[model samples]
Target: MVTGTLDRKQERIIAGIPPVSDFSGIYFYTINNKSNHELVMLLDSIIGLNDSVLSDWLNITPRTYRNYKQNTDVVLKGNVKEHIVLLLSLYKHGVEVFGNTADFEHWLTEKNRLLDNEAPYSFLTTVSGIKFIDNRLTALEYGENV
Candidate 1:
């Protein structure tokens, strides 16, 4: 295991909630390192998915999710960390495509007729789902009416 402390800058970058447009470099780096539970909390604050739902997305029981939150330095498993990063990236893309975070967040929760009245939020449980959403965002970005 790679054991070390994250300097304030590194923590700031990782905990920046929805990452900015040039976040791919940092995203790639974070994928290989373990993340603190605070990342999860920050993500929750922005997405506002309750722990129960978020825990399910993380593929862990609610109890384990709570346990993770208790430890500030807890290192999330690789898959969990990757899922978080991808979610962040998806949100970042959403914000960019929609021109604001609020609209993007609204779009995530609101059911879309194009998607057969299913809220895009329902697909956030897996990495493929995140990618699928990202692709949809790309379509919107190009004015393809997705």
Candidate 2:
């Protein structure tokens, strides 16, 4: 089973989805209630990723990100929404493992031998890559050396 330190609301948000073993299942939980402003806040507040990285992950331009932040009514769709859910889920696991946001963010950007000297953040752009990172994080949680 997928384990983490997520609160009841976060757990409820992801309850419909399958466990993290099927990492792609995370995309099935759409962000229906949240506006763009909420998502942006979550990204900044939880994951601590910057605007440039978020823009790249969402496949949106920097200007669009600013516009979304400026317009509270704007809602995200398509890849942007999917990426946000994925990141939020990952952030939960990361916090559970690392114990704090700063440590998780550092681990994300730091090169790891298990990942062939690549930072975990490099995998955030694609579904398959996110799955691989999730698998690695699961392994780490279970005391697997790699």
Candidate 3:
């Protein structure tokens, strides 16, 4: 992690954002690595599904997929199912994976990018949440082609 007050010289992204917290790199890349054409496209292209697809899928026109790109907490509010689906779809196809919010936020801070995702103001990561999503959740149920 960068230190000493944002010197603003070496402005480069430090790491891959798993595209999510639920799945680790192993699981995330495994799904996307398959020979699935749709999955491949999702990986190479930065934001896979645009706002329209998410809104259409979740039946919410006012919302945006860009909003969904950050922490899962806020996105889940409008429709937990949709938020989770987007994440699973991304993880299953995306090449990288972030372990948790700390890792994601660290990247944002280092890159000096706008941190806009609406994570709950007081959200805290927990062991159970990680375990549940990683080991217990059914991948296919959430659009993970794995």
Candidate 4:
């Protein structure tokens, strides 16, 4: 869960409509049939990733990715849903650490020597990669430089 005054763009990264009164409230990452738009927004708008790249990450064809965008009622399941959840979790942690979205995005794209000179964002295409990045984020959250 996360708490913050998210703008419209930030809202796109979330799985559901946040509480109106408490702008800064915890957000749980649970995507379902109804939240397909959110996933699309996260990948296209927030992450600035193209459909082809996103499709590749999800191990789906570009045509399927297009279908997902065109069909509002499309429901994501299995590994694709799991991967989106992982990405949202990583973004949440990055925001917490950087205190802003831009800085976090920069950090994500910047090569890190600790990660064997690979940009953190480059490791987001696999489950193992997600775990590795999450571990690094946790370490940073706990004041570990690495």
Candidate 3 accuracy as lDDT = 0.34
* lDDT digits (tens) for residues 1-146 of candidate 2: 12354455545554443444554465455534454566565565555667888777667887888787777787777667767767677766776777777887788899989789899888888866766777778888999864
Give residue 128's error in model 1 in angstroms: 0.8
State in Å the error of residue 71, model 4: 1.0
The 10-residue segment with the lowest total lDDT in model 3: 6-15
Assess each prediction's global lDDT (C-alpha) against the native: 0.69, 0.68, 0.34, 0.66
TM-scores vs. true structure, each candidate: 0.73, 0.77, 0.23, 0.70
Residue 140 in candidate 4 has what lDDT? 86
In model 2, the worst 10-residue window by lDDT is 1-10
State which candidate has the highest lDDT.
1
Clash pairs detected, candidate 3? 18-96, 18-97, 18-98
**Can you write out model 3's per-residue Cα lDDT over 1-146, one digit (the tens) per residue?**
22222223211211232434434652554443322332222322333334564344344552443454433343234233323334334333322334443443343224221223423111212323333333312452466532
**Candidate 4 residue-wise lDDT at 29:** 38
Strongest candidate by TM-score: 2
Tell me the spans in candidate 2 whose CA falls farther than 4 Å from its real position. 1-28, 31-34
